[model samples]
Target: MDLIGHVRCFVAVAEERHFGRAAARLGMAQPPLSQRMQRLERELGVRLFDRSSRQVTITRSGALLLEEARALLDRSEEFLACATRIKDGQSGLLRAALPSGLARETVAAILADLHQHHPSVELELEELSTTDQLARLASHDLEVGLIHHPCDVAGLELGPVLRCELGVLLPRASLLAARDEVPLASLTGLGLVLFPRADAPAVYDDLLTTCARNGYTPDSLRHGQGDSFVHGLILSVNAVAFSPPDRGTAAGSPSSEVVWRPLAGAPLAWRYSVAWPHGRKDTAIHAFADAVPRALWNTAAVSTDPPPRPLHLRPASEYWL
Candidate 1:
């Protein structure tokens, strides 16, 4: 009775909950699978399963053991794969999704480094909204995501990689264009362009609350799905909006038709994070997460700022243009 064989049988039975199904999955006879389990119980001096005529269930000990077993198996596989890759002198692929708000050139710079250093490794990039990034990560559609903070999605973990202050984006010819920055209160009477609730409910709510605290409700002229669309709306109308500070390109080329002024009176800032499924303990995920901040460091525009204080503590000077 190999110890590893018994461990596999135990995990199979725990997951399938039926000896016959577990044996089928393991490509063995039911009697041998049952014997393996019984031998395991004898060795451990505990019953791992509760079997009735109608159904089979795992005992409390079995449930706990299952977690440890799975972790052990995952590590073993990872070790073998890493060894194989190193022997072959080849790495694997990293699939990632990113939110549009992150500076595009910053992402490009990171990808360039990965490509140059590990030519054998491949990266697949997708442009998704923050909400889409969250959903895809949970469903395993993406291994890692670059996203905004304040995500409430279950079964996901986040770490802040970079922070940017939100600034007002207005048309150059708009009445608010003369100032370097405008306070939230000054925009109370103005129509605003905001992200659609479906695409970014958290951002939308934050904007609403920020305005409400300033004693005004913004009149939304349109709701957009992404920054490109939002910029389009700004160009077409007198509507104003807020965005991260790295809104310009790497060369600091400003938008000709638009003027971005720091938001006055308690500035609002957004934290961009590296997010993945909580259950995912893959090497690739860890590598990508570790690489993100370093990648940002390679590009000077992206900075890791301390989390901003509560909207109230932010002074008018912080929002200066």
Candidate 2:
């Protein structure tokens, strides 16, 4: 109730020690300041100043209230300063969701750049499947997403950041292992390890459609949910699977036991894009999104063709054990 008004009047009067001077300091007429002080005293049921013919002095209650009032004012100023920083985008929190398929190195590069350049911006990351990412974005649970493209969600904007060719993972000794690239049709009857079609139907469908457009249906031998598990299956079994080239790192170390080959005739490679609500623009979010591709594009040095066969293949024994 009239706290700001009372605090203003009290501060002015205490500093000036004279009604006329206080009115001038407050840039107001004397009568209104005097009235405001009177109203404040009446509301608090306590007289705050003592008046005499020659001077005005602070009462005991007035001294105590003045101390509290100064503290309140200091706190109010601090609050406003923080609010201004947030409004100006000099500082704030960013909530983002990223797809599990995103490369760890790619994320690390972006985060490192952000940490160095935007010390005031705090970031929080959530790993969500592409479908879940879309849902979270639509519900406003996430501010942005790093996702695979062709997200046709209404009211969502998608901007391509990286276009990665799909590569097949196979045991080094597999028949197709010596090839630099293979057509999807070549894997027609091979055991395929794939992401579970049911859990993330959209990604599964995209993969299937890509294969179908090449005139073949991928034969699924085992289905896993996330990249980790799927990669684990590739390492443990003699199975072959298709994934982005960066996924080679999932093997733990470059391996002689496993190899990756670009998928020839694969209809449109995967495109990773940044997705956000169409009209929700945020500077820090945009900055981070823009930095991602620039950070990742040339860092890995992965080739469109598989690397030349290992000059000296370690004995399979080394990997088997």
TM-scores for the candidates: 0.61, 0.77
lDDT of 2 by residue, 1-321 (tens): 578767878887987789899999889998888899999888889899998867779898898888888888889888899788777555788888766666778778878888887778888888887778778888888888777544445777655446676788777666876777787787766666865544355545656665666765644458774665665676676567877778765542565566777777545455566778898667767766776666557554322322121111222211110
Q: How displaced is residue 123 in candidate 2, in Å? A: 3.2
User: lDDT winner among the candidates?
Assistant: 1
Candidate 2 TM-score over all chains jointly: 0.77
* Model 1 Cα lDDT, one tens digit per residue, 1-321: 587778888989998999999999999999988888999999988889999987889999989899887887778778899778744435666678776666666787767766666666667788787789878877788878877655555677665557566778877777777886687777765667766667656655665666677665666557764666777787776577776666633212354777677777545766567888886665566656766777766553456765443112222221111
Residue 209, candidate 2: C-alpha displacement in angstroms: 2.2
Candidate 2 pairs with clashing backbones: none
Question: Candidate 1 at 187: error in angstroms?
Answer: 1.3
Reference-based lDDT, residue 154, model 2: 72
lDDT of each: 0.70, 0.69
Indicate the worst ten consecutive residues by lDDT in candidate 1: 312-321
Clashes of 2: 0
lDDT of 1: 0.70
